[model samples]
Target: MRLRRALLVSCAALALAASALAQGWLDRVPPEIHGEVPARAPAGEPLTVRFSASEPVAYTLAYGGETWEAVVQNLFVLRVRPGEHALVVTATDGAGNETRVAYTVTGVGAPAAELHVTERARAGDPVSVRVTLPEPPAEVVSVRLGGEALPTFAADAVEGGAGRSVVALGAVPLSAAGTLDVEVVVRDPFGRERTLKRALEVAAEARPVQELGLTPEALGALSDENREAEAAALREAYRGAAPDPLWREPFILPTEGVNTSAFGLPRRYAVSGAVSFHQGADIAAPQGTPIVATNDGVVLLTGFYPIKGGLTVIDHGGGVSSLYFHQAVMVVTPGQRVRRGERIGEVGSTGLATGPHLHWEMRVNAVPTDPLAWVGRLLP
Candidate 1:
């Protein structure tokens, strides 16, 4: 009995020691959020810290004299001053055991304006210019493009502490070419002033919608059942969440014609007070107009879709894509390679359309943006 008791005591003591040793203090907190600073981040932007652990626990993080807490599977967004800083996150389990990890923070200034140009946009292509601010309160106290005050943001009052702002530049007119100047007026947090100017090269090209064809019968069918099928196909093609840092490059209009419907304009489909936002621009061109590829890309889909009629989807690099719909003919097939200005199909009012017009649309990483913004001067 004495021997058995001694053995039991020894086993218990060993087990307790092993349990204490297994409670890894260092392993409690992850190394990434606790250790090194990210290589790049916008200056004065919020610092997002992710805390993850297998066990359910609460955590308290401290950085730059600010303390924050995170519940299980929760993230904390913290703001830090510019330059280098330190961060620490502590985790306490249900047993009151605590562990901590530390990290460094390095601040970087916002990205400078880059000249985004495209070779395919023609005179009537819809365009949009958006400027992203580097810090919160992303409001532009003052802004200008080409010595002209661009009407992008609301100029009435500033809200939050938006230290940053974005101004979307409008489109150039059809047949507009030459050097366009862009200027931006900025006011800093201390009420200081700064100006940014850039000269852009505008190359003129003929839009392809000039050759698209349409018929009245095709238009009637397009405005009916075909419309729903086309929308469903598009939604299916983009089933998952979109990629980050969507394409910001200039886009070339896919078809050529006089723009009939404008982007962001309200469309009253019925006289009974039903209205919807115009998502894309409609180019009123002749039937059988040859649709052209807007940029260099590979064909993602090609088939006689239920709603799109004959549709061709081209995937441009960097998660950017352009879709040509309601074609009278499908010249390209799925998985085909195409270059800018290449022939894809002839436009028709095959699917759901009110008339024989080419419905042109542009998407950046699946987000709908103004197509004319890439095509030259639509906005004066």
Candidate 2:
């Protein structure tokens, strides 16, 4: 009889515990809330709304008497009409417990932005895009020309204004011609996006060419086997598009010689078949003439090659690089830090050259431009 009484008391305790567990289930598990209030939107513009919950939830997102429902709430966007409106996000769990989040949306004037191109870019010429933002900063700014993504770099504004970003659209080809279109994409902090299109008329100009008499034997002797790999390596090494000018001062010529040849004139090496551009100014100099650094930079490449001969490449940063080829002897090592007017090598005709001349080339983002343009001035 005592045993039976004890068993009955234990059963009663279990029933009470199960009753309390059933009653407290809703209190134990509740909906969680996260995410920020969106930025200001334009009048009559759609306001983008986003929020998150810990679990699957039923949500009622309301703004100005207009309501939207989400059976499962994680990421969603809702458009609301412009003007000041209170946005209420109510998330309910399976147990009917609700978590409410509120934010004030003040729809003011649309966020203003503009794009300015510094110059009319030629084919194979470097182009820059500058964007100006509204008083309230945007979350992100993007630019594109000819349907290609242009990488942008942020910079401080000159004359003390809002921040600006400069994107270096490296060396577009003549193929991107005619009515060129630049697409600017801007997104505010509130997930509202504004797209603007700017049309630029590009001029059609043919790249110049030159003819050279080179025998087939001479051309084949220039190590044609590894030429592509070497060229690719050099291009990859100097492909950086830095925002700030790596060179603080104007560039000075490396050697004392008359410019016998200029950049961009593609030399037809064979009678009718092979054509390659002369990327540098071929300045006639003595084989032992000292070759100096054009400006302050890090020596990225220094070695003898079949085409460039004894070559030395100095990276002046900001996508500007200088190349001195056909050196008799290289004084500096690769990765060496060099200064303006410092002797880095001696001019020579060690590789595919007619005589002793320093082939000095100035490249911006690996596209060869006139070295003289960069000499005695600040430029690409």
Query: What is candidate 1's local distance difference test score?
Result: 0.57
lDDT of each: 0.57, 0.72
Q: Tens digit of lDDT per residue, candidate 2, span 236-316? A: 766543445556677899999878877656678776766676667889998899999999888888787787889888987
lDDT of 1 by residue, 1-380 (tens): 99999999999987876776577432333322333346445557776767675566678878778887655544777775666677777777755557787777755444333223233343333333444455423235444433545445421112223423343434434334775555665554434445566655666543322222334454355464667766676666654322221222334667778888765455554333344555567888888887888766677777776446677877754334677766788788766778878889887876656566766666654545456665643221
- Candidate 1 regions off by >4 Å? 1-229, 239-250, 376-380
Worst 10 residues of 1 by lDDT: 154-163
Per-candidate TM-scores read 0.41, 0.65
Residue 3 shift from truth in candidate 1, angstroms: 68
The count of backbone overlaps in candidate 1 is: 52
lDDT score of model 2?
0.72
